[model samples]
Target: MLFQVGGQGTRPTFFEMSAAQQLPSSVRAALTYSLGVFALRRPFIHKILDYEDEFFALLMLVLETHSLRTTDASFSESLYGLRRRGAKIKLKKSNLLTNSADEVRHTGLRKRQKVLSVVFLVVLPYLKSKLQSTYNREREANLQASLWGDSDERFDGDFVTGDNNSFGSRDVSNIEASARDRCIKRVRKIVGACYPWLHAGNEGLSFAYQLLYLLDATGFYSLGLHALGIHVCRATGQELMDTSSRISKIRSRERERLRGSPWLKALQGGLLSCAYAVLDYAQTGLIAAVFFFKMMEWWYQSAEERMSAPTVYPPPPPPPPPKVAKEGIPLPPDRTLCPLCLQKRANPSVMAVSGFVFCYTCVFKYTNQYKRCPVTLMPASVDQIRRLFHDV
Candidate 1:
């Protein structure tokens, strides 16, 4: 399936090589993460004072509220009753019937009911207690229905849902400016600590996140936010974001600062690092999948004599075919599309790669070798100068 296209002496392309060619995907992904270093060149700045101001604003709102619960007592009772009766809302109809021992063979209804009861009695009301007036508004949740097929058995009785846990009612009303001061002081100390690259003088964390997000290289930045979000939520005895308007703002700004600090190198260095990271991700995804399946097999066999496997749903239906070429219809016209990102937009460069013209800027941003041709998935190189063809 893979034969080199260039001359014999030239090295084989990345796409042509097997995934064992690189570090394990998980390891590579971990290594690719920016520890506020080696990625972003130009950081974007935000006003941290805005976060401080909003925290106090929110604190006042909470203090003013006579009743923390938005809905009346009757409505609260109704919601509680629904939870007690095991009225678990499965938006996707198929999810309602999933793994039912009678049908799908692994619902674990009794266990699930027990979990639901704990959530309703202990967690649900506490979470509801912290909701802001706006949070009480009707909200729409997105659903992704997929089909999964796995050869592992360990996942048989496991159930997954978005509602993993609920928070309890508490006056996170206590999370104050002292907490804010301490958090900021701690970060300042950490960034300033004994690392040449992580110097606060060299990079602003806020700027780092913005640039990395712009370059689509936000791996650790997001993880940092999630871990910190959990940390803040627990420390304050309520949702961290609910502590106060100002604290919530600080939470956001904190994530922005911490995540952004990566890739905040001098411009050229940042761009090169981003290119390296993204290319690495695309290159390593396959290895991760294979390893995942292997792990599942090992776990399933180890679980018991015949434990059921994790239910992996099948992939959703394929997207409708493009309208560009209907049978027997003429092409509308040659339109410019982003040669790099591939998302068509206005003002694309009309340069050729593999005899097709594309936006030069798009191609400039796109990396070859690691992630090759957009359409064909073949190895690519820029053809800045026209190559001549002749009869031999």
Candidate 2:
């Protein structure tokens, strides 16, 4: 028999054997296999799988709710444990799938779940802010290093201050004073340069500059909204009055001058009568281009004739009236459930002037790309449209 002993110093007690010390190869091999199975069943290994299954199930629920479909085997492989750099991925692909019956119950597991939920809900928001700050710090450091050579102690890398003072201003007050004087000179020169377009009421050029300033303020993606905004902006009553007054004065002066130079007027009339040549120099914006064409066409015409022309001003253009199902028409609404989504009930709002009725939502969803009305080749509104169908 071997004696087990304990030591107070650095050495650990080892099992002491008799003369027949070494175990046989078969016994050692069996012991190694047992140790491998025991190691594989460690608590932490199970814990990851448990969390992953729950996490993946939640994700699948999310994707399914958003109309995505998937299979189980693919999801299983995703959840299988794969060690990455220290931090673990919270969810595995296999973890993304599980049925209600697969759920396990344990009081401690529930408490741990609550703890996880609290961490995600409470700490995750601030985690992003912390990450943002870290990114900004790293970005600023990169900018500093790029601008100036790294210091001996990382002279080229990120630094609070640099060796070069070339970009620095003399002082705030001196800079401001000099800036003020320069601004005054710049303002004067800009006024001189813009005098022609300004007095000429070049609305198109002015709108371009306004749009560019807005792009600089916000960003590129917002250009569409801002571009559309320009129409509403200068359409104000005050702006309209100013433009009208300028155009009226210009036209009146031209009419008076033309009375004395009929020969010159005739000469200009011949050259400018070519509509395409006149429109070649037309300005930006659809409305502006139309206005320019009208101006050029009516420029040499009599002012009396211009004033006498029936004007389409102020009142907005009216939209076409809804189709009145042509007196004796029958609306053939196919009452059927949607096979894809299994939604029951046909939508009457999307009655194809030809009589086929579909769910307004489905009709529009399909029609958007197809550009054909589900029932007929009739047009449809792209806006989040509400349908109003009156019974014929």
Candidate 3:
């Protein structure tokens, strides 16, 4: 059975105290929701439009950190005030121990404090985890439709293959495939714009989480040390106030140096702004280079095939008999027949080096076998032959 405690002093009861202690957590939740829905969500519209999700997550992180620090400072101040008030009340109650009402009040306060501690430490964390789980589940369900498309509702079996369908079905399948690809692309863009850190595993307790926690822990540790130092100075009756003032002056000077230096600030800002652009350009260039090299490779393979292909030659005709000529006169040459085949020309072409016309097949076969022109016998190749437009 649970016991009840009643109090009528300056001290608050268990439920009231617990509610007061949870003020920071409540403020943190409100700030997170406000920043996420109002501030970060505004970027989502612009982010989706721009198709660039690179820095939105980083901005969200900065805003979240600022909100957490603000709430934490408030909570710390409130806790310090409560501790000081409690100490004062305890001292007064000790002097009034002879009063029965004072004794009862102290007992009730102690019981209430214990109950409040349990509620805040145990019950609150469990509730927070349950709420987070529910939120994640709902978010996943809503976003899933944007990724998988109507396929989830349509096909219950494996994808069809091997051209076993009618033309209409094939066209329908092609359209569905194209639609599915488009849906996947849209979903990727939305996810990237809304939550860049999701891919980087910073959505939950990750490096960013640990780093922020460490900063808070260090700040609280320093505060604890400062409090301890003050307590020690008071106990020893030492004058350390001047020393602390000097230290503060030094810190202020350092801060001013950091803040006032123009070059350092510019350098930092430039790095932050241009680092992602450089990385993205580098990635795109690398992909383009790979595709360009693949195209070049395919071009080279096609050229090699053309070069190695066998050239077909129609059966060579008998060589014509040399015409006898008078001592000082040369016989007129035949214009209708090819010099290589000694027959009627078929698909005549011309050699660039010797300017001699020959049949296309005859010249290609001769060049492939002998690599020389038939008339001049000069060094010639298949590439030097040009197809003639006129019939021989």
Candidate 4:
């Protein structure tokens, strides 16, 4: 009797395994296959379907308050179990098999599954991509605005009270500004949908983004000004006042456009001006400090050399040679020519240490680069050269 009971249990287990094998695969697999087929036919569909699993998983988590695996198991198993259960009901009602009730129930369940498959595989991805594109536009607009500043240009003439030329220009400016503002507003609205803090009229966030941009602009301007100053000090003798005035004008214009009350505007302007002044002063002071240090170093070196030199007394000179003047003989080659170029010295100058004559520009350039005399190879400097005036 125990052997017979075990045999019966084994028969049911075999039947169940057969039934499970006949059941459909998971809903996620079905959806993925459908999306893959669609993407193959329409290449652009791939963009939305690339993250199909993630999107469906997130949707399931939000709606059912469970993970994708749990939800998928429940969906696929329940649908297959329902069909099997309905078949068992039909078997019990075999006497009334001619009644069509089982067929109607099975048909309804199939229709419901079809609708669900369509929604998950098609509708959800389309909506998500649309929403994503809208938000993307807004983010792009915000980035462009921050980097390039506002695109709007102010019109100097009034539309209604101006002459034909002025009216035309004003109209054109207004049209351009309106188009640009419209685009910006559309993008901003989309961004605000995702991040409400970035919505229009959110003064705090807007001001913060603008302040960061201002700081970046100020830093770049300061660097450029510093470079210009160095160029002026080395190559040209121009004053910094002109550059300062131009920068002030630009700052004033920017401040005028900034959103603020008169007092606030004035305060910000003052702060920026102060910052610019500090930068200018720092650059100028650094240049002056370098020059002062160089002068002190030279003084110290000269003092040391003077103290290190030997003090020797020379013997008296012999009788002077007789003076002879003969114009017929060819004179020896002029030794005053520049050794570097072997040419008559133009703009003649003397190196203080070597007491040698050379072209002022040639020797000055050489010393400035190498810090030594061209002929004697002794240490020299451009500053120690004295311009020589010859009586022609």
Candidate 1 vs. true structure, TM-score: 0.13
Residue by residue across 1-392, what tens digits does model 4's lDDT show?
Answer: 00011122111222232232232223344445455667888988787676765665554433222111121212222222211111112333764656544321211113344344334434644555455666777768668779876555333354366456766657778899989988978766855575544333444643553454345322111122122211001101121243336556765786677678888878988887776565435424433444555565678799999999888979789655322224212223677667556688899898887666778888888899989776556677888899889812
List TM-scores for all candidates, in order: 0.13, 0.14, 0.22, 0.21
lDDT of 1 by residue, 1-392 (tens): 01123322212222222221122323323323321123354232123222422432342233212111211111112112110111222344565567533221112124444433334323433333323211222111111112343313435675544554432222253366658866865654443343335334324774575456445354212223222221000012132234345444643463454433445534545565564454334323434544555575577678854566566899899765333223212322433444344455334333233344344454444533334344333445555413324211
Better of 1 and 2 by TM-score: 2
Clashes per prediction? 29, 13, 0, 0
Local lDDT at 51 for model 1: 42
| lDDT (C-alpha) at residue 183 in model 1 | 88
lDDT of 1 at 88: 27
Give stretches of model 2 more than 4 Å off: 1-362, 365-371, 377-386, 389-391
Please give the CA lDDT of all the candidate structures: 0.34, 0.38, 0.46, 0.48
Q: Regarding TM-score, does 2 or 3 come out ahead? A: 3
Q: Give the alpha carbon lDDT tens digit for every residue of 152-208 in model 3.
A: 575668666675645555787889998997896676456545443543442343344
Candidate 4 backbone collisions, by pair? none
Q: Which sequence of candidate numbers ranks them by lDDT, best first? A: 4, 3, 2, 1
Query: Better model by TM-score, 3 or 4?
Result: 3
What's the CA RMSD of model 3 in angstroms? Answer: 28.4
